[model samples]
Target: MLAIINDDLAGAGRPESIFISWLLWQPRGVDLASEALKEVQKLARYEKVDPDIARLKALFASLAGSDRSMH
Candidate 1:
């Protein structure tokens, strides 16, 4: 998933822990602690949703379903 550190993600003097909140709401946000693979500040500057993020959400949903095959 492409991670973008736009203004929303980075507030003025925003604590690092804030990322935890974002991840909590978005279960697909994996590997957030590592160095960002992609940072499109401009791309996320005007919008809230990004393509990579949407795909990640879909991927996470599939993974969740895969884990529940026993039922």
Candidate 2:
């Protein structure tokens, strides 16, 4: 499933590619997910802001504070 999504993301544009990058990082663990979120936030500054980005940032922020392990 990840491989399939990665293949699709290869051709994706801008913010979609950035968001997909975070999706790919998610299952690895909280550390990676946090790192990916930071990268997303940083990259988002250079691109036109999207409402979905804010939503995703909020989602990631909540996940970061959760005690549940991703694995």
Q: What is the C-alpha lDDT of each candidate?
A: 0.36, 0.47
Q: What would the per-residue lDDT of candidate 1 be over residues 1-71, giving only the tens digit for each residue?
A: 23444466444223233333445655475664322222222223323365544333333333344322111
Error of 1 at 49 (Å): 0.9
lDDT comparing candidate 2 with the true structure? 0.47
Runs of candidate 2 exceeding 4 Å displacement? 1-33, 43-48, 66-71
Full-model lDDT, candidate 1: 0.36
Question: What's the C-alpha lDDT at position 20 in model 1?
Answer: 39
Top lDDT model: 2
Local accuracy of candidate 2 as per-residue lDDT tens digits, 1-71: 11113345455533355456656756644585566446445534533365644444454544456433222
Show the colliding residue pairs in model 2: none
Model 2 scores a TM of 0.34
- Candidate 1 C-alpha error for residue 27, in Å: 16
TM-score to true structure, per model: 0.27, 0.34
